[model samples]
Target: MRRLSTLFAFTLIVLGSCSPSVKILGSWTSPSMSTTGYEDIFVTALTENILARQTVEQDLDNLLNEKGVNAQSSFNILPPGFKTSGVDKNEVLQKIKALGSDAILTVAVLDQTNETRYVPGTTMYSPMGYGYYGRFWGYYSYYNPVMYDPGYYTTDKNYYLEANLYDAETEELVWSSQSETTNPASIETFSKTFSETIVSQLIKDGLIIKE
Candidate 1:
C-alpha cells in the first residue's frame, strides 16, 4: 500500500510538470487605427520549412476570414519557395497592395533553446504526534526529521515565435507579439493555437473588429 501511494504521488508530479504554455511577451498597436479588426489582411509565415510556413499562413487566413475579414495568404501570391532574389521587395509589396490588403501579417520563429539543469528535490519533515503528556513537554519535545532523496535533473526545450502586423499602406508595423511554448507537441497544433491566440489578442486590443 505504501509503495502504491508513492507511485501514485510520483505519477501526479510528473504529469503536473508536463504542461505547455503560451503568452504574449510584448505587443505594439498603431495609433492610427481607430477601430478594431482590419478589413483586409495579407497573411505570411516566414519559416525555413516550406510546408510549415504554408500551413501556418493558411490557418491564419482562414481564421481571419471566419471573423468576417478579407484575408489573402502569401502562399497564393508568392510561388513555392519564394525568396528575395531577382524580384524586388517593392514589387512584391505593390502586388500585395493591389490585392486590396491594408495589413500584412507575418509569423516567424524567433529562437529555440534546449538545456539541462539540476532540479533539486524537496525535503519535508513530518510533524510530531501528540500523546497524553505531550502538551506538558511540548517545548522540549523532539522528533527525528525524515529526509527524501534529492530529485534528478532533467533537460527541457523551449521555442519562441513572433507575429507581426504591418500597415501595408504606411509600411509601418501596426502590432506585434512574441510567444514562447515549452516542448511544443507538434508544429501543426502549435501553429493553429498560436494563430488563434494572435488574432484574438489583436481583437482584444481593438486593432480589428469582429465585423
Candidate 2:
C-alpha cells in the first residue's frame, strides 16, 4: 500500500514539473472594434520559415473552426511567392476582401532567447518518518520526503510572439497581444495553446462569443 501511494505521488510531481509555462503578457482591444467577431476570418503567420508559418496558420484555423468560428488560412489563399511586406498593399487588401474575410488575424514570432539555469538539490524530513510494523510483520515502514540527487543545469527557450486582429474594411488594428511561451513540448501544442489563449481573450473582450 505504501509503495503504491509513493508511486502515485511521484507521478503527480513529474507531470506538474513538465507542464509548460505560457502566458499573455499584455493585450489591448480598440473600443471601436466590432463587438461581434468576424464570421469569416483569415489567419496568417509572419514567420520566415515557410513550413513553420503554414503549420502555425493551419493550427489556428483548425482550432478556431472547432470553436464554431469561421476561419481560413492565408497560406492556402495566397500564392507560394506571396510576401507580407514590400508588396502592393491595395492588391493584398483586394485579395483578402475577395475571400469575404471581414477580419485578418496575424501571428508573428518577434524574438527568441535561451537561458541556462541551475537548480540546487535539497533534503527533506517528516515527523512520522518511520514506524515498526505492529505485532504481525515485525518489519518497518518508512515515509521519506523525496530528495533530489544533486543540482542540475538545464537550458530553456523562450519564444516571444505577437498577434493582432485587423479590421479588413477599415484596414485598422482592432486588437493586439504579446505573449511568451517557454519550453513548449511541440509546435502543435504551442500553436493550439497560443490560439486558444488569444481566442479566449477575444471572448473576454466581447470580440468573440463562445458557441
**Top lDDT: which candidate number?**
1
The true-versus-predicted C-alpha distance at residue 162 of model 1, in Å, is 1.5
How many clashes in each candidate? 6, 0
Question: What's each prediction's TM-score?
Answer: 0.71, 0.75
* Candidate 2: stretches off by over 4 Å: 1-19, 84-86, 124-148
Q: lDDT of candidate 1 vs native? A: 0.72
Clashing pairs in 1: 36-208, 36-209, 37-207, 37-208, 37-209, 121-151
Q: Per-residue lDDT for 104 in model 2?
A: 95
RMSD of each: 11.1, 11.0
Write model 1 residue lDDT over 1-211, tens digit each, in one string: 0122322322222233345566777788777754645789998876546666666788888898898888898876787667688988888999999999999888766665667889888877766665625565553353335567788978766566678888888888878888766655555666677778888888888777897
Using TM-score as the measure, the top candidate is 2
lDDT string for model 2 (30-118, tens) is: 98898677777888876445555666788878877877778888865675566558888888888888988889998876666668999
